[model samples]
Target: MDAHLRELRYFVAAAEESTVTAAAARLFVSQPALSKQLRALERRLGFDLFDRGPRGLALTSQGSALLPVAREVLALWDRGYAEARAAAHPHQLVVGMQTAVGRDLQRPAVERFRARFPSWTVSLRLVGWDDPTAGLADGTSDVAFVWLPTAADLATRVLISEPRWVALPTAHPLADRAEIPFELLLDEPFVALPSAAGPLRDFWLAVADRPRPPVIAAEATAADEVLELVTAGVGIALLAEGNTDLYQRPGLTCRPVPNLPPAQLAVACRPDEPRKEVHHFITCVQP
Candidate 1:
């Protein structure tokens, strides 16, 4: 009925306090002004919101029904306002990721970005690994830290290229071995990323040319979950060797897999609407 959130807030505060004096004190408005606002709101709704009682105030049926609805509207408006404010004010560079992007890479990149763009700030946004492009596909990030073979629409600059490694429970039979062949891991049940990850999921599974499907023990969206599943002996998983040391843990051990194709870590962004800041950040990380 074209009611503003400010009116809804006044109505909700009045309803909760059950008296104009208390509502005015809570809202920092005069008692007469609060009473006038409530009267206007009721007139807009074509209803009497409250009845004046000797002791305090009592809601009519319409006011009782509208109390929660008004509170909800006020809460939603507050959240939307905060989001718009952040969007309007920031000179931020949001980099999205799905895994443990090592500080080894991040520190260097950010240091260079600061030197190049002193007035800017950097933000790291962790997203679910289900989407292979991280948040770049949907424009949630100015750029993304993702594995190779992301959505074809994105342009990328490589960061690190490293061989795949397998993380296994320390107590597993094969954990004592120094290295393993890609063929050996075929029969082992493995933890996998979500199906929406597309070809990147296949790369981790070493399934580019394999005829048989992987026996997925569990699905995970982040590196920690994969390591946890392995530590619990749920199954083994593949990860880039560069991250093997970063994610090292007592219960899990990672070993090189020599036969699998190496993965490329890259900073990716949409080529069509590339931001100048994102381009500068990419140049900082490029070899």
Candidate 2:
């Protein structure tokens, strides 16, 4: 049986928002109308897509399984639409990165893209944590070096898995240790990302299973702030192990966490507005 693309789109939106009312607002439809369409789609598919409960709508196993397929279909369509738009008019491709991207693993790929599209000018923008996606939402940059768990709407290609390391003040008791346990950090006051970061803030806080709130001594938007705060004894911060040398202070030291997983570094772009230059850049970065 052929599935309606609109239905799949609505279902995915609802799943991502986790509330029909929110999904309705996002899709610019009335709640009752959206609900009716969802019901109709479920019947057509012969499966219950979500578990409606007091907390909100939770995806069933079937719905979770369908999510990636839906995203892939949408992504391919979006890429085609972007390619068409780029073909009609020439435009600059602005790339943003949090650090000096000269040493980036994708440099070789970028060189190849330049050889193929010599007429396109690729400009690089230095971005801070203030806007991790480097203005992808507002079109400041066509694409960016971003961390994952970003705005769910952006499509990305992961570049590296540089794991997290904790920076401790030299005077602190744990500074002498070669490594620290993740559990030890549970009790310490931590430096946090800006509140505007939303889900990103929570991810940096490592709050997935935190029962009680944490003590936040400071908020950092860049490596300098992270070092300044940690050195002044304001709070400790977790950062990529590779960045340890970048932010070292006279009174600061870095050590790995025994059990925490690595953080993903990636190149991100708006899936809905992929530019040809961005597509070529993504192609260069892809392994």
Residue-pair clashes per candidate, as listed?
0, 0
What TM-score would each prediction reach against the true structure? 0.68, 0.65
TM-score of 2: 0.65
Candidate 1 off by > 4 Å: 1-90
> Per-residue lDDT of 1-287 in model 2, one digit per residue for the tens?
67776777788779887989767755667899999999988888899889999888999999999888987776565556546544655566777776544335557766887888887777778766656676564456677877767765788888778777888799999988889887888888999876445466677777873657777888777667777899889998887776787666699989998667677778888877634667778878754
Q: Model 2, residue 185: what's the lDDT?
A: 83
**Model 1, 12-73: lDDT tens per residue?**
76776788876775466899999899899888899998998887789999989988888777
Give the local distance difference test score of model 1. 0.80
Question: Candidate 2 — which pairs collide?
Answer: none
lDDT of candidates 1 onward, in order:
0.80, 0.75
Query: What TM-score does candidate 1 get on C-alpha atoms?
Result: 0.68
Model 2 off-target regions past 4 Å? 1-91, 99-103, 209-211
Error of 2 at 157 (Å): 1.5
The residue pairs in collision within model 1 are: none
